[model samples]
Target chain A: MMNPISRVAKSLVLLFMFFTLHATAQKITPYLQTTSQVLELPSRVLNETRTIYIHYPKADSTNPNKTYPVLYLMDGESHFEMLSQYTDYLSRWDVNVIPQMIIVGIVNTKRTRDLTPTESIINYFGQPDTSRVSWMKPSGGNERFLQFIREELKPYVDSHYKTQPYNILAGHSFGGLASVYCLLTHPEMFQAYIAVSPSFWWDREYILKLADQKLKKGGSLNKTLFFSDASEGVSDSSTFHTNLLKFDAMLKAKTVIGLRFEYNYYPKETHMTEPMPAFYDALRFIYKAPYK
Target chain B: MMNPISRVAKSLVLLFMFFTLHATAQKITPYLQTTSQVLELPSRVLNETRTIYIHYPKADSTNPNKTYPVLYLMDGESHFEMLSQYTDYLSRWDVNVIPQMIIVGIVNTKRTRDLTPTESIINYFGQPDTSRVSWMKPSGGNERFLQFIREELKPYVDSHYKTQPYNILAGHSFGGLASVYCLLTHPEMFQAYIAVSPSFWWDREYILKLADQKLKKGGSLNKTLFFSDASEGVSDSSTFHTNLLKFDAMLKAKTVIGLRFEYNYYPKETHMTEPMPAFYDALRFIYKAPYK
Candidate 1:
């Protein structure tokens, strides 16, 4: 029912459409996918089955024999994913500076109990809140918490996976306090430590005094340490920055051998927001020199 | 055949050994397993089939409807894993600012051809290389390359997966030049554009000239742009810093509306090393003011 010229035009349009469809059918290749699992751990100290989160790089045909370093993070429930992603990207085979590492996020059952080093009735503002809902009621159980890690957790991870002995202990706030605590008490447990906005005023700077006592004059302590503080507002006319400064000075005076350390102050960043840039800087500083 | 006391002591040692083995076994847990896959893409424009590496987060049993934003990265074979890990970590439900985004890495087929705009014989030294092994032999195929993305690649991605319209385009070096090229030619293609150490030295700074021409005076251009440069040594009495400064001036003079722009220069970082920190800074700058 159509003329030759009209039919010719129609066929040309159909041909163009067909080629377009074929071109559009080309598929895009994805670069990365991740999976997260909830791991249950029985903590004899807490007398409860605590759920810890573990994030690791997935294995592919191209990299089946790859083994990863481990970063045991505190406050795992809060910032586990942040550290997981940071390690994954920084150590990517292509990015390749820091080695691909496994992230073992230790979720907190009772933050006050596990992160604090000593029992104290004082709060952040030096005021005692003896209320039933007091956040500091169950404080000072870090020694037992560290025991949970040394006795129960580390063995579990080592036996279950292909892990390198190089380990890093990292945390923020109370978790940050715990990171420094672990470094001071159990230095041999980890190769590196990261403490972001550590609660240095805990039990009137208990960890500060401990560091002074444990780090003997002219003694050798070979380890890497990264600590940072953000703009934490003053409560009771006492600034958090002052405490951090004092702690920084204490560590500097010790001058422990092979102690690769960096202290960063983020004025524009808040306590909660400091992790974004702090973690990135930490990784860069930790792996500044290439791993041979 | 031994004496009673000696036999009893041997039996006690064996019992102790059995308890130790049983205790160690109780402490260790099984390793968590994950999987990965590789994807391939064939392009007629470059006459090559490129391999794209992929890593997907393992699906969580608790949350299944978590759709991710897609980051279409240039120079996939170079920095794909870095970006992948950054996004994954920053978007973990705890440290969420930007949503968890899927990374679509476009591996280069013809590096020089697809990334450049004009077919020129100009080398980095501002002289023509007329030799057979010239790196710029088949230069200037960005138009067709972008066509492949618009008609062929994007459609394929949209059809194959769950993608939000909010997309980001990122690149470094020559790939950085391509990022700006796409921004000028196809303004609406991506929500954000990241160019780390863009080669403004390309084609006598053709992209800079094009930016001046296309960006109309007092016009609204709603886009987030993060560009940066690193120290590339002072050569021929000229430094890489001067080039970046010029580009920064051009953007400031235009003063395009709704265009959020941040420029960073790393004096200590090298061209190859800048991407690590620059990319991290860019992400922070892009998401500085989070959506409530």
Candidate 2:
């Protein structure tokens, strides 16, 4: 014999509890996971310990046998997350094109020191800054930087992670210049190379000369290269665009066998903005055909 | 008085201990001082708990008086990381365009139900789909779905986080349809709308018809909109391209004041691959003039 009002109140409480618990239980859980590691490298050239940021897809316990290709990117502090996200999404279980690769972001200690070749006074404006404590001080150590990668870094990464031998070296601006340098000097280091708006004017275009010297006429240099430039450092005079045109022509003139290359010019995009589209296009171009 | 071998062994032991301590020290150091929380919403209509991934930029404790714009993204599960990474990188003190904003990724539960305006039997191939448990079975609930967003989701987000009323709603394909629907039905919900590769063929082009009905001729609909499409479900005979062309024409025909709009067509890109480039273009187009 319960009163009608009391019975209604009891029912209301029960209903409230049910809704609350239901809402609490309905929480949507995320399935995405990530793993990261920091490696400290003693750079004898710079006499400093450089920390590299390495981010890889979280190993799926269910499929332990899967191995991944590696992408070595310069300007790690700048574009690590971009590459990481792109790699993760493109290599998703559903949308698999590129393999789930390890991203080795070489964080800059002295950007100019590692990314530039030939210690010179040339700036983006093609004018020399003779000022002391200029940002360009202690420049042109890309050769040693490449050595660090070829000798020290690559071995360390291969040993620690499940990796495929196929590797890609990517860079932007001075990092772009470094990527090209690697391609010309140490062609065996990477299977593919991506240079987004390389400062080809670096050291009076030292790498361009190297390319001309290294690549013989109609020689076979089996590799994939993607180079792009945005509406950056492009003036009324022949500076940015001209340099890229020269590089493009050099590759074409060489008629280098097994050299699959593409040059993209984004007049609408700024230097900073070019990486977004360029990186996407680069990945697509690199993996355009199945690994032959 | 130690022998040479004993000295070498002692040095090796010291080196191992030093390395261990160094590794421990590195492990304790955090890269980003930011933390994020995941939000879950259950929809009785969709029969699923929709997971909305969120990334709120770490509040600068030094500057207590700060607020941010919100970028509401569709297809949350697919492109959340891309947007998150883009926002984080672009808004760094180095490359600031848009203010550091909170990212709200609206994951799909009933994608077809929430995105399509009408229930139609037409399939992608222009054939009637009569199969049981078809993906298009529970369709044409976008209006109610929008109500859920405007009433339930937005309120919850505003109440919990510090947000400015200026919001951007972004989507792709079916999500794109929902975005355009929101713009037409609830214009006050967001300041900007982005529709990438919208499935214009949905419900025999119901949205195009709705747009004609809702958008008053020569009216002022002060809002920004970006719409784009790739080669999706398009062959020699399909009307996907024609449908988009008609929609674009309708948009242009309306002399809506303060209506900023951009239409892009990527012949090289496919529907599945268009999101990467389309999203980038959308962001750049939306933020272009104001930034310049």
lDDT of every predicted structure (CA atoms)? 0.77, 0.82
Candidate 2 lDDT by residue in tens digits, B127-222: 789898788978888888777778777777888788878899989888998899899999999999999988777777778888999998899999
On DockQ, the candidate that comes out on top is 2
Per-candidate total of colliding backbone pairs: 12, 0
Residue A109 lDDT, candidate 1, scale 0-100: 76
Distance from true position, residue A251, model 2, in Å? 1.5
B168-219, model 1: which lDDT tens digit per residue?
Answer: 8888988888888898889888889999988777777777888888888777
Model 2 residue pairs with clashes: none
- Candidate 2 ranges with C-alpha deviation above 4 Å: A1-33, A43-46, A58-63, A235-238, B1-34, B41-49, B58-63, B235-237
Error of 1 at A102 (Å): 5.2
TM-score of 1: 0.76
